[model samples]
Target: MINVLKQASEGLLYMSESEYPFEVFLWDDSKQKDITPECVLQKVGLPVDTLVEVVELDSFFEVAIAEQDWHNSEEKITVKKYQHLVQVLKKYLFDLQVMRFGKINIDVYIVGKTSDEYLAGLSTKVVET
Candidate 1:
């Protein structure tokens, strides 16, 4: 499944999972909002079940940097820096995929099912946080 990132804090996803169809949330004006499943599909131009995975850059890079052999103690990755890196990486990766494949067929993983099937199993009701 391709993970689509919509929020930064991990807990926010969990808190809103009971409400929205997806496992992510967006905070606006100190209120949590459901990032509609349609939005995700629109961004990737793929169906819902395509497994759009979300990357929590700060947490991800923290573990990755620690696991890597070349660890830098002087330079550390902050949330802001991580977000910048991820933005740049996504742009380049998206461009590379389009250039090499002529389309975004595979995104980090092979999609197992269409987003329609995925959304069917989710709640469509709009919830307020």
Candidate 2:
């Protein structure tokens, strides 16, 4: 599963106002019940007291990969690769959610439960000015 994720996320960058690479991670101890903002913080070794904002996966993607340059071949290819990555995640995981931790430069976790009920997905940083 990790290999599949690595392959799907290869060369894909999550673009906000800035571009960032997606890093795949697998939490062997994470369960389906641990798919909450609070749990996400702990899983990622963040302070439990830190604030976290939950955003829907589709909404996050729509903004992250917003249409910028349809005519540019490189941009077009990147967009398609991101879309494909999303599809791959959906195909392999369930109960997916986007967890945004902090303001300005936010830590984003696009996480979901694997077939074995463990948390597995990609994490990235998004700088919003």
Candidate 3:
């Protein structure tokens, strides 16, 4: 993940259908055209018993070199090493909620700074109404 992030940190990373074999995407806000950048930053720290598990990836790729699997599925996350990132993201947003909006939802804590990166690295299109 660090290597991939490092590469993406420099510029955008694009994946073709041969790379991530995703057939289709159905978004809830397909018509929404803009996403307001919330000033709040939520940081989720390391491995919490409460977070979505980080799935075991097979070399981060499988099948004719094309894959569309949700990598972070039901796998358990161990706090042996990766606990800090999650904590930083989750706690940051939690504090942001109390300080700014007085309420923070689960989505905010999970998305963190990755929201921008996710949208950038992935090949999916956005159609914000």
lDDT for predicted candidate 1 compared with the true structure:
0.30
Measured with C-alpha atoms, the lDDT of residue 124 in candidate 2 is 94
lDDT of each: 0.30, 0.84, 0.24
Which parts of model 1 have CA positions greater than 4 angstroms off? Answer: 1-32, 54-57, 64-129
Q: How would you encode candidate 3's per-residue C-alpha lDDT over 1-129 as one tens digit per residue?
A: 333433322232113322121111112222222322232221213222332322212222222133235434322121211233233333332211111111211211112123322211111111112
Candidate 1 Cα deviation (angstroms), residue 52: 3.4
RMSD of each: 15.9, 1.9, 16.0
Which of the numbered candidates is closest to the native, going by highest lDDT?
Answer: 2
| lDDT tens readout by residue for model 2, 13-129 | 777788899999999964667588877887788998776898888888885355575448787777777677878889998999999998889999999999889998899999988
TM-score result, candidate 3: 0.17
Q: How displaced is residue 86 in candidate 3, in Å?
A: 22
The candidate with the higher lDDT, 1 or 2, is 2
- Between candidates 1 and 3, which one is better according to TM-score? 1
* Candidate 1 Cα deviation (angstroms), residue 14: 25
